[model samples]
Target: MKTTRLAAVAIIANLAFATGTLAQDKELGEAVTIELNAVKSNEGGCTLTFLVANGHASQIEKVVYETVLFDSAGQVDRLTLFDFGTLPPGRPRVRQFSVPGIACDALSQVLINGAHTCEAPDLTDGACETGLILKTRTKIEVTG
Candidate 1:
């Protein structure tokens, strides 16, 4: 009888822990989402497209990231700042950058090295890094 009670308590504790974890996961998913939407190669160069969404309560006036581009062989091609201007709350925006010399197929990874600018009146100091989610729809991988 004592063993049965202990088992029941253990099950209840496990269920509570699982519930808390699920809530945390859901909250994290609702944060800022940066998706590498597409990459196009033209005569000039390769244009990389990003789909950015702000899930915060306040609007971001400007946010820039020091981005690193990697070649197909995992070598660093170049580093540039991408200014995703004026991200409104709960809205998705598309931003594009053109590289004059890099081919679209040559890029295998993109990394958000750090935030160069994150301007918002009401946001925290580390607002740009907090709960940021990175995704990629193309073959190239993206990481923060």
Candidate 2:
């Protein structure tokens, strides 16, 4: 019984080590850049097409982010999630998001609320908001 228990402990330890190293090897990368082209009024509100392009060498599986939209009076109308699932490396993936009850022109500012999960290491502190940048088209930055 003791022998079996010891063997089980050893196996569990090895598995843990392997998994930790694998995560470390993959290496969590940085957040990608967001390109906001144009916002058009849609059925109920407005639709904005944006591109999630690679900002680094690592492959990105998912990007969980939040967006804050300010109305014409600079008041926050709504906050929504912008999850870019499985971004292709070295290729630009265009994604669309619809904001209900909000006009395209009514938006005064759009900010990246937070970076919930980005890259391999996951949960990067302020990586989605403060570290955010607009490479093209939309000049609105992700700050604060």
Candidate 3:
């Protein structure tokens, strides 16, 4: 009987997550806006630039995100943690990621990873990533 109850609880949790009833989508991702800043490729490697803005009243320490880079042949994902030092409540900053040996042509798509790093100033809550607002300035595709 106990096992069945446990299973039922687990299923309900999953259902809640799938329905966006949790605070993950609604309360989070309100502090910052994420955008594609640029993408460069060369012998060195592929560089991806991103802009993160803090729209709330609290200063954020860093913006950590996961990115999925779909290349010509496969996909590459990375959890990028950038220390913005301090976003000062309403400022935006650009963070860069450089991956050697990967060219721009190989990149087919770019997706932002989930959940916030939750790093923030002492006076504010740490769920900065949850409060961030995500945006796309340009498509993550490369042209010859």
Candidate 4:
């Protein structure tokens, strides 16, 4: 009877730990939303102007943009990384990045990966800043 009780306790403890880990993973997996306005297709590739507003919490420090371009078939054709600098609390910023080798006709969607790396600001010593990861999905229309 004692052995059975011990086993049950161990199982319960393991389950608690597993639940906590899963929650953390889910938070990290949540996608960030990015709005791309006025996307134009040129002769060579495409140009996109985007803005991120209230995309993160005040605790967030640095965000890294991992962009993946997909074709109409839903196959990933290009992957690009844009490192966005530090973000201040409650401040909105706009940035632009060009996508090369992407044809307007073949373009389907753009995936933005936002990775939050919250650390102490080099200029000032402070407490731990929370980090965030965001992924945005946007559709594109081809115009000849």
Candidate 5:
């Protein structure tokens, strides 16, 4: 009886530790993913489409990311901020930015410099950047 009780306690303790580890992993995996979806060049300039998804439980009222555009020659083309306003939890949003005087083919990579703004009532500071994920469906490489 004593051995059985000790084994049961050990099992329970192991389960508790495993449960806590799983929760931490889940929290770390929950993040905002930004995907560079597409790029189109028109008579004016270029239009870049982005797919933004919020995986957090809280709603983000406003969020802006400073982005650096790199040319095909590996030179900085321009730096600007892209505002992804009102990101609801678990909802993917599409946003577009028009870059005047730059062709889509001229761009080679886009670097997410940092978060310019992250506004949410329930989120702590730096919440937008702490677990941010970057992706790209286009030929251009995206990095944070």
Candidate 6:
């Protein structure tokens, strides 16, 4: 009887682990990656087009893309946000943002808000903020 119970418990544990692993894999596969293509310098402001690709198993609804610009002095000069409603699975979306008074060389960092929470990261005591004005690709999971 003891051996039989232990066997049953072991099987249950194995099944649970497998299920968790599969769920994690699915979530990871459903993430969306954003790639910065080009930043055009206009006379009035800067135009940025970021390529966003969704790999989720399901469609993401009501997605908002925001681009926060930081200057060379590490201060936020402009914040431009765009709302791109629904993004179907395996589709690429282009989001544009215009930042006024943002010079090409003066830019130090850019933040692509995927969740749209707009939570400010702690930047105190010489600690670097979450993102800086540089060309980098980051993934924001909109939906699972």
TM-score of every candidate = 0.79, 0.65, 0.60, 0.52, 0.79, 0.55
106 in model 3: Cα distance from truth in Å?
1.4
lDDT of each residue in 79-114, candidate 4, tens digit only: 777555555533434557777777766777776533
Report the backbone clash tally of model 2. Answer: 1
For model 5, residues 26-95, the per-residue Cα lDDT tens digits are 4435578887877889887999988777778899999999999999999999999999899887666778
Q: Kindly list the per-residue Cα lDDT of model 1 for residues 18-128, writing each as its tens digit.
A: 434433444544367787877899886899888777777899899999999999999999999999989887666778988889899999999999889999888877777
RMSDs, each prediction? 13.9, 16.4, 15.5, 16.5, 15.1, 18.1
**Selected candidate, larger lDDT, 1 vs 6:** 1
Off by over 4 Å in 4: 1-33, 55-61, 113-138, 141-144
- lDDT (CA) per prediction: 0.81, 0.63, 0.57, 0.51, 0.82, 0.52
Worst 10 residues of 4 by lDDT: 123-132
Per-residue lDDT of 20-77 in model 3, one digit per residue for the tens?
Answer: 3222333434455665656778576887766556666666655555556666665654
Better of 2 and 4 by lDDT: 2
Kindly list the per-residue Cα lDDT of model 2 for residues 17-132, writing each as its tens digit: 53343234323345456667556789879888776565454556677777788877878888888887766544556678888887787877787767677664443344444445
- Model 6: how far residue 127 lies from native, Å: 29
Best by lDDT: 5
Ranking by lDDT: 5, 1, 2, 3, 6, 4
Poorest lDDT segment (10 consecutive residues) of candidate 1: 18-27
The RMSD (Cα, Å) of candidate 5 is: 15.1
Clashing pairs in 2: 28-121
Looking at model 5, report the run of 10 residues with the lowest lDDT sum: 19-28
